[model samples]
Target: MNINKQKMIRNVLEQHSNGFYMQTQFVILHNRFFAGTHVHVMLKINNHFLVEHFKYIKLLQMILILELIVFKIAKDLIQYLKIK
Candidate 1:
Protein backbone atom coordinates (compact mmCIF):
# COMPACT_ATOMS: atom_id res chain seq x y z
CA MET A 1 0.00 0.00 0.00
CA ASN A 2 1.00 3.61 -0.46
CA ILE A 3 2.11 5.87 2.42
CA ASN A 4 -1.27 7.61 2.65
CA LYS A 5 -3.16 4.35 2.84
CA GLN A 6 -0.77 3.07 5.48
CA LYS A 7 -1.19 6.25 7.51
CA MET A 8 -4.96 6.03 7.27
CA ILE A 9 -4.94 2.44 8.49
CA ARG A 10 -2.67 3.30 11.38
CA ASN A 11 -4.90 6.19 12.32
CA VAL A 12 -7.96 3.96 12.30
CA LEU A 13 -6.32 1.32 14.43
CA GLU A 14 -5.15 3.93 16.92
CA GLN A 15 -8.59 5.50 17.15
CA HIS A 16 -10.28 2.18 17.83
CA SER A 17 -7.63 0.61 20.06
CA ASN A 18 -9.24 1.69 23.31
CA GLY A 19 -13.02 1.58 22.88
CA PHE A 20 -13.07 -1.04 20.11
CA TYR A 21 -15.05 -3.90 21.47
CA MET A 22 -14.71 -7.08 19.48
CA GLN A 23 -13.85 -10.66 20.37
CA THR A 24 -10.17 -9.95 20.86
CA GLN A 25 -9.62 -13.39 22.34
CA PHE A 26 -10.97 -14.95 19.19
CA VAL A 27 -8.75 -12.82 17.02
CA ILE A 28 -5.71 -13.74 19.09
CA LEU A 29 -6.54 -17.42 18.86
CA HIS A 30 -7.12 -17.14 15.12
CA ASN A 31 -3.79 -15.36 14.76
CA ARG A 32 -2.10 -18.47 16.09
CA PHE A 33 -3.18 -20.15 12.86
CA PHE A 34 -1.00 -17.67 10.96
CA ALA A 35 1.78 -16.68 13.39
CA GLY A 36 2.45 -19.19 16.12
CA THR A 37 4.98 -18.48 18.86
CA HIS A 38 5.29 -14.72 18.57
CA VAL A 39 1.65 -14.15 19.31
CA HIS A 40 1.86 -16.75 22.04
CA VAL A 41 4.73 -14.88 23.66
CA MET A 42 2.84 -11.63 23.49
CA LEU A 43 -0.15 -13.23 25.19
CA LYS A 44 1.98 -14.93 27.79
CA ILE A 45 3.67 -11.77 28.97
CA ASN A 46 0.67 -9.55 29.55
CA ASN A 47 -1.47 -9.84 32.66
CA HIS A 48 -5.02 -8.46 32.81
CA PHE A 49 -4.02 -4.93 33.71
CA LEU A 50 -1.03 -4.98 31.42
CA VAL A 51 -3.25 -6.16 28.61
CA GLU A 52 -5.18 -2.92 28.84
CA HIS A 53 -2.00 -0.93 28.75
CA PHE A 54 -0.49 -2.85 25.89
CA LYS A 55 -3.57 -3.45 23.82
CA TYR A 56 -2.67 -0.84 21.25
CA ILE A 57 0.77 -2.34 20.70
CA LYS A 58 -0.70 -5.80 20.31
CA LEU A 59 -3.25 -4.53 17.82
CA LEU A 60 -0.49 -2.88 15.84
CA GLN A 61 1.50 -6.10 15.72
CA MET A 62 -1.47 -8.12 14.49
CA ILE A 63 -2.33 -5.53 11.87
CA LEU A 64 1.29 -5.44 10.73
CA ILE A 65 1.24 -9.18 10.17
CA LEU A 66 -2.00 -8.94 8.22
CA GLU A 67 -0.66 -6.08 6.14
CA LEU A 68 2.42 -8.12 5.31
CA ILE A 69 0.32 -11.05 4.16
CA VAL A 70 -1.82 -8.79 2.00
CA PHE A 71 1.18 -7.10 0.43
CA LYS A 72 2.76 -10.45 -0.31
CA ILE A 73 -0.35 -11.65 -2.08
CA ALA A 74 -0.61 -8.43 -4.04
CA LYS A 75 3.03 -8.73 -5.09
CA ASP A 76 2.52 -12.29 -6.26
CA LEU A 77 -0.57 -11.33 -8.22
CA ILE A 78 1.29 -8.51 -9.93
CA GLN A 79 4.12 -10.84 -10.89
CA TYR A 80 1.68 -13.40 -12.27
CA LEU A 81 -0.08 -10.74 -14.32
CA LYS A 82 3.21 -9.51 -15.75
CA ILE A 83 4.16 -13.05 -16.74
CA LYS A 84 0.81 -13.61 -18.42
Candidate 2:
Protein backbone atom coordinates (compact mmCIF):
# COMPACT_ATOMS: atom_id res chain seq x y z
CA MET A 1 0.00 0.00 0.00
CA ASN A 2 1.08 3.57 -0.47
CA ILE A 3 2.57 5.12 2.66
CA ASN A 4 -0.25 7.68 2.83
CA LYS A 5 -2.94 5.01 2.64
CA GLN A 6 -1.17 2.91 5.28
CA LYS A 7 -0.91 5.93 7.56
CA MET A 8 -4.56 6.76 6.99
CA ILE A 9 -5.62 3.23 7.83
CA ARG A 10 -3.44 3.27 10.91
CA ASN A 11 -5.04 6.56 11.97
CA VAL A 12 -8.51 5.19 11.41
CA LEU A 13 -7.75 2.06 13.37
CA GLU A 14 -6.34 4.13 16.19
CA GLN A 15 -9.42 6.33 16.40
CA HIS A 16 -11.45 5.80 19.58
CA SER A 17 -14.91 6.93 20.53
CA ASN A 18 -15.58 5.13 23.81
CA GLY A 19 -12.47 3.29 25.00
CA PHE A 20 -9.23 1.49 24.19
CA TYR A 21 -10.55 -2.02 23.54
CA MET A 22 -12.30 -1.23 20.27
CA GLN A 23 -9.33 0.69 18.87
CA THR A 24 -6.94 -2.01 20.00
CA GLN A 25 -8.96 -4.69 18.28
CA PHE A 26 -9.15 -2.58 15.15
CA VAL A 27 -5.36 -2.22 15.09
CA ILE A 28 -4.75 -5.90 15.79
CA LEU A 29 -7.22 -7.02 13.15
CA HIS A 30 -5.68 -4.68 10.59
CA ASN A 31 -2.21 -5.93 11.45
CA ARG A 32 -3.22 -9.59 11.15
CA PHE A 33 -4.92 -9.01 7.83
CA PHE A 34 -1.99 -7.07 6.38
CA ALA A 35 0.54 -9.55 7.68
CA GLY A 36 -1.09 -12.34 5.70
CA THR A 37 -1.53 -10.57 2.38
CA HIS A 38 -0.87 -7.59 0.14
CA VAL A 39 -2.63 -4.24 -0.04
CA HIS A 40 -5.30 -5.54 -2.42
CA VAL A 41 -6.10 -8.31 0.02
CA MET A 42 -6.15 -5.88 2.89
CA LEU A 43 -8.71 -3.74 1.04
CA LYS A 44 -10.89 -6.75 0.32
CA ILE A 45 -10.63 -7.98 3.89
CA ASN A 46 -11.39 -4.54 5.26
CA ASN A 47 -14.47 -4.31 3.05
CA HIS A 48 -15.66 -7.72 4.21
CA PHE A 49 -15.00 -6.98 7.89
CA LEU A 50 -16.79 -3.68 7.58
CA VAL A 51 -19.76 -5.55 6.23
CA GLU A 52 -19.71 -7.87 9.22
CA HIS A 53 -19.15 -5.16 11.80
CA PHE A 54 -22.49 -3.60 10.86
CA LYS A 55 -23.27 -1.62 13.99
CA TYR A 56 -20.64 1.03 13.37
CA ILE A 57 -19.92 0.07 9.80
CA LYS A 58 -21.52 3.20 8.43
CA LEU A 59 -19.40 5.41 10.64
CA LEU A 60 -16.25 3.56 9.74
CA GLN A 61 -17.08 3.65 6.06
CA MET A 62 -17.68 7.37 6.22
CA ILE A 63 -14.38 7.89 7.98
CA LEU A 64 -12.50 5.83 5.43
CA ILE A 65 -14.16 7.64 2.55
CA LEU A 66 -13.38 11.02 4.07
CA GLU A 67 -9.79 10.01 4.62
CA LEU A 68 -9.35 9.13 0.95
CA ILE A 69 -11.11 12.27 -0.14
CA VAL A 70 -8.84 14.36 2.03
CA PHE A 71 -5.78 12.61 0.66
CA LYS A 72 -6.85 13.35 -2.88
CA ILE A 73 -7.50 16.97 -2.04
CA ALA A 74 -4.14 17.31 -0.36
CA LYS A 75 -2.38 15.82 -3.33
CA ASP A 76 -4.15 18.23 -5.65
CA LEU A 77 -3.27 21.19 -3.45
CA ILE A 78 0.35 20.15 -3.32
CA GLN A 79 0.52 19.83 -7.09
CA TYR A 80 -1.11 23.22 -7.55
CA LEU A 81 1.25 24.88 -5.09
CA LYS A 82 4.22 23.29 -6.78
CA ILE A 83 3.07 24.64 -10.17
CA LYS A 84 2.90 28.23 -8.86
RMSD of each: 14.8, 14.3
Tens digit per residue, CA lDDT, model 2, 18-81: 3322322232223333334321211222122221222222336545543453445456657877
Candidate 1 RMSD computed on C-alpha atoms after optimal superposition onto the true structure: 14.8
- Residue ranges of candidate 1 with Cα displaced over 4 Å: 1-57
Report model 1's TM-score to 2 decimal places: 0.36
How high is the lDDT of residue 26 in model 1?
Answer: 16
Q: What is the C-alpha lDDT profile of model 1 across 1-84, one tens digit per residue?
A: 255644554565445444221312212322332333444211111111112112233545666544444445456657877999
**Per-model lDDT:** 0.39, 0.40
Name model 2 segments beyond 4 Å from true.
Answer: 1-57
User: Distance (Å) between predicted and true CA of 46, model 2?
Assistant: 30
